[model samples]
Target: MAAPTAWIVAAAPLAAALSALAAAFVTGFDQRSAMPPDLAARFYGFFLDRYPLFAFAIPYGVARLLAVALAPGRSGALRRVIGAALGLGLLLGLSLHPTFGGMVLRAGFGTGSGAFLNGTPMAAAYAFGAAAAAGLFGSALGLGAALIGRPGTPRPGSRRRRAGRAILHALAGFLALWFAAALIGLAHDAGFGPWPRRPLDARDAAIAAGLLTAGALPHLLLVAARLRRATRAA
Candidate 1:
């Protein structure tokens, strides 16, 4: 049981490293196509392609897996921290994409009459953001439960505080944070070319998805194990 959590914790750095690798690939692709001249109009194309894999898939997947794998058991505090970091990181990462950032800049910096034509890329950006947010939301709920959860070895006749309440609190927190970041990112783009859109490429997508699975799948299995234990105990 404890070994699962250990495995999940071990996977965090692996996930982060994989995420960085994905980001690098995306950046690499963008750099390659930067001066092709033929594909210039797709100024934001590079970002559009790779954003989902790096920003959403890698981070969110890894974190969720960790959450599920590290079901509270005895080391509740550590799990809570890992879960919170995942949620917060996803919230921040989702809002930082070029499309969203560009929109924020355009709204603020376009000519007084609004000359800037910048707009969201739509499909990839929003989709990526949404996925990341979802992951964060789930982690918050899962971790919150661990935080206020009853000890496995409770005294006789003790009532477990509502796990559902903790879950809700975590979920609400993640949503609030995500929405707030989205709003702020929008605002920032309005003010700032939001410059240099970092287009995501195919490699980025593949790596992100891979990293996500590598990180999260195990954690989910861990969570399942916990649920099974609980059921058996009852």
Candidate 2:
């Protein structure tokens, strides 16, 4: 059976954004907890972090989807331009958000009213920045993949294959790091871990690592799949 068109188009970006936000929120809430910890707070933090990624991915993914929907022999120049512009605009807009702008000003100049925001807002700002960075980077990568896998692109036997393999290998390494961090966090929570030597620190690291890994999985899978398809096409 054929897959739904919308799902096919949105799957990668949606997965990427959701996974990253999930990890960030889980970590943020875990760190902020006191006493018994608040599930509601955690959920709130998750949604807060999720909004930027979702917002950013929608336009970016839609642009890419439109590009892919074009005729196979058609030049992708316009699509590429649109994708880059949209990705950049989205990141720039997020960077300009008051909470994020304040955070950056505080970090870079150390001369802003960090008092402008606190707690979830502050966390969301950070999440927005991180998501933006990832989105931009992923967009660039998507462009590269599209170029390399273009309908009539040339394929240099070992070199092209080697490059593709290397990219996949790097992704695997990242996944391993994230998995290990998650395990470490789990162990610490269970009262049997080392390295971090502090419960809170371990928990934070684990949550972040696990979430990042999860977020990256979709991109890695998409790239790998593209490479396979390109190889076959060649």
Candidate 3:
């Protein structure tokens, strides 16, 4: 029982690392246009099309691996710190976007420069401060989760644990398949650049969906773990 469970636990991280590596490849393959607005459009397009979804999965996948890797040794303080840090990082990212430059939907060169450049020095300072705070917070959350969750070790299994593992493994498999399909779609090159098309290509849409699925994996894993534990204890 221990050996097999251990293998599953080990596999979780392997999966996450592989997924992260995949994300890097996807980002690299989808080159952004050179112009600032075009770049911004590509950046925003990545996020809008499906990148945000994929982004969340990454954190989720990494978190799951971390949970297994850090378990037993982890403490309560660490969990709190991690929660805090994630919360803060989220906050900082949001706050910085506005002050760094007023949120202009960047189009193309000379497309909307005025909107893009509408931040005062004071605004910049505030934005920077917010970013710093967020970083500190995210750091705290990571530390706290590490300490408290005792992340690496799998808890003793009962019927509930088994069921939970089954669900998670299923989820992981699904995500992996989804990612593979997305990669295929991306490879098709529905349209490399951000020039608007009358109708977005199917391959591009699939890629977007795949990216989102990747991003959401982390949160899904967290929830599954918690629920599994709860069911086991009950």
Instruction: Give lDDT per model, in order.
Output: 0.42, 0.39, 0.40
Model 1 lDDT on a 0 to 1 scale: 0.42
The model with the greatest TM-score is 1
87 in model 3: Cα distance from truth in Å?
8.0
1-234, model 3: which lDDT tens digit per residue?
Answer: 233343444345435644653554454533342447744553444333421222333344345435443443334655545654665454334322432211211111112233336553643433333333323323333343433453333456798977797567545544443343233223225343231222234454455445445533543454445535543444
In candidate 1, what are the lDDT values of residues 93-162, reduced to their tens digit?
Answer: 3334344323322322222122223354553454346435444434543444444342232223324454
TM-score computed on alpha carbons, candidate 2: 0.28
Off by over 4 Å in 3: 1-82, 86-203, 214-226
What stretches of model 2 exceed 4 Å from their correct place?
1-86, 94-98, 101-200
TM per candidate: 0.31, 0.28, 0.27
Model 2: per-residue Cα lDDT over 1-234, one tens digit each: 012332344344445444544444445433344533443332233222322223223333444434343324334667545655655454434433443332222232221113224434644444444433433434443454354233222344688786886567456533432332222223334433232122334454444445434544554455345434544555
Model 1 segments more than 4 A misplaced? 1-27, 31-58, 70-160, 176-234
Q: Please give the ranking of all candidate structures by lDDT, highest first, separated by commas.
A: 1, 3, 2
Report how far off residue 104 is in candidate 1 (Å).
19
The whole-model C-alpha lDDT of candidate 2 against the native structure comes to 0.39
Lowest summed lDDT over 10 consecutive residues: which window, candidate 3?
101-110
Identify the leading candidate in terms of lDDT.
1
Tell me how far the alpha carbon of residue 70 in candidate 1 is from the true structure, in angstroms, after superposition: 4.8
